[model samples]
Target: MTVPLAATDFHADLDLALRLADAADEQSLPRFDAADLEVSLKADHSHVTDADLATEQAIRDILHAERPDDGILGEEFGAEGVTSRQWIIDPIDGTANFLRGVPLWGTMIALAVDGVPQVGVVSMPALGRRWWASAGDGSWTATSDGARRLSVSTVDSLDEASVSFQSISQWAQAGKTPELLALAERVWRDRAYGDIFSYMLLAEGRIDMVAEFDVKEYDIAAAVPIVREAGGRMTAFDGTETLSALSALATNGILHDSFLSLFRDLPRA
Candidate 1:
């Protein structure tokens, strides 16, 4: 049975997620540039590291103790338990960058009820930044300076939009490269600022839109609420409200329909 969470409960979960992120940062940051770091590849051909396993294990330990009834789906360890309330975790969202000593990676954690994300936390220790949101509690970010509420940009048209699509390869692989390139030509500017950073930038009002392919649920679950609470919109390329979608399209709400229109007739892989 699915028991709904009240606003206070969501806030409490948000706090717990933040604490988990702290532990994640501790486990991941020290390994970022370690001389003895261990790296391996997953079945999907994506990179994974010792830091990823350790950080996810630490988080799983806490969730196992604190919310044993809740289910968990993690990038490194896979899913466990079965419940309407599940914690989705991507211990390290950008392992490729982490391995390269780039600062574009972060830890993503989210609580979803009946498959709807209600609380989210993204911590980028290397970048010294964190962003979070709980349903109805608003989105927020903490930096070296301090914390502040987040909001998406007000850009209302593709002609005035600054967008990030993660990568050209994703579109090419999806058989939508021409469509992506055409959309890029219509937008004010385009960047390949792939990974969770692009969504965080969208939440911070620094970027107007983000669309990507070949992403898993854990890859995006934590970002959905952060974007939604920041006055932005997130949906699959088909315009559905779902985190399970293989592709994602996020924008400052005003531009969602316009953005969706661009891919209306394009073939998606």
Candidate 2:
């Protein structure tokens, strides 16, 4: 499925997103495993680190000077302005993994026009990998040998699919553990390859499906375009095309409906 794009070119915005990711990586990598890394809890009890704050600030600084008129909605600092064009950011998508020295964490950046993501960049400096895409352009990943365009796998059957459910605890908390387990039993394999990496893997054609609960827009915004541009499909679990649903179900375009049918009757958030 094609991602929605305004008449304007997205190349410049996508370039800025890449630069923002670079800045985020610069601010975050040094603090990855540092003994002095400060960690704290938000009111909701989720962990936040000094690196999360600093990295987001670095990205914001650049946006403020480069695209001062665009709005900003960031995980750390909250919303900044109100406009049709907005930059959504999650400086450290997997802060728990980051603070624990796991190499699975990354930075997420996206430019949404009228609430639809048109440009996206996900950077995993710890893993030396980055994936990006703009609406109409194909998804691509930077590689040592140069860059490779991305495409989803051709797995068309649930029994043959490899799925990533993100976290079992999330399903349990959402009261959807039974459904998750049922889906897991049907899939060829199931794993909780949490965070944005799961979506990236799906975009790269290495995984067939990814579903998760209790996610914010920033968590999935930067992934929508990449997945869509890579010939995959992403939407809320209930089959609606939206990021505000607080849940996500992404799959190879061929398997999207089959995956959605599993959770079709559940009440949305």
What lDDT tens digits, residue by residue, belong to model 2 across residues 54-81? Answer: 9999999999999999999999999989
Q: What range of 10 consecutive residues in model 2 has the weakest lDDT sum?
A: 1-10
**Model 1 TM:** 0.95
Specify the highest-TM-score model's number.
Answer: 2
User: Per-residue lDDT tens digits of candidate 1, residues 184-231?
Assistant: 888999998989999999999999999998889999999999999999
Quote the positional error of residue 118 for candidate 1 in Å: 0.3
TM-score of 2: 0.96
Kindly report which residue stretches of model 2 are placed more than 4 angstroms away from their true locations once superposed: 5-7, 265-269
lDDT (0 to 1) per candidate: 0.90, 0.92
lDDT for residue 223 in candidate 2, whole number 0-100: 96
Evaluate residue 40 in candidate 1 and report its C-alpha lDDT on the 0 to 100 scale: 90
Q: Cα deviation of 182 in candidate 1 (Å)?
A: 1.3
